[model samples]
Target: MEYTKLTLGIALLVAFAWILFRNSKRSGVLHALIRIDTIVGMIAGLYLVITAVHSLFF
Candidate 1:
């Protein structure tokens, strides 16, 4: 379960980075992808922080 979460987090991070650096042209699809990527990145970041805090305390 932990490894699965870690893998997903890494994959999301890579996808977010790819989307971020891919292009500057803003098409509709690009805009949507950027939004999705941003959300995924935020979720991944929050998951990591929560996991860290949980581990540290309990």
Candidate 2:
């Protein structure tokens, strides 16, 4: 996939994961969901940054 596509995909995935994590915490389904959100968000941010850098530098 192209860098833009990858970046957007990552962002959407991260958002979805975060929403799930937040909702899961309400019912006390899994305490680890928050961690998942954090990790996914970090990965998404990394992807976005990398894409931006590549677009600018390359």
Candidate 3:
């Protein structure tokens, strides 16, 4: 598995989520979805970062 690509992709997802969050402040449901997406993306990004670091130094 390419942690680099996954991390980069998650970064893109977070960026996209940021854009969506800003643009969808007028809606309730969309905000909920965006929040879920952001949380998932952040968790995945954290896992990837930890795995990458472990692979590098362990």
Q: Write the per-residue lDDT of candidate 2 for residues 1-58, one digit (tens) a residue.
A: 4567556756776776677667667766465554576567667766776777677678
- Whole-model Cα lDDT per candidate? 0.62, 0.66, 0.65
TM-score comparison, 2 vs 3, better candidate = 3
State TM-scores per candidate.
Answer: 0.48, 0.45, 0.49
- Worst window of 10 by summed lDDT in candidate 3: 29-38
lDDT of 3: 0.65
TM-score of 3: 0.49
Clashes of 3: 0
Give lDDT tens digits, candidate 1, residues 1-58: 5556656666666666666555334555566556765767857855865675565567
Q: What is the alpha-carbon lDDT for the whole of candidate 2?
A: 0.66
- Ranking of models by lDDT: 2, 3, 1
Give the clash count for model 1.
0
Better of 2 and 3 by lDDT: 2
Candidates, ranked, TM-score: 3, 1, 2
Evaluate residue 32 in candidate 2 and report its C-alpha lDDT on the 0 to 100 scale.
50
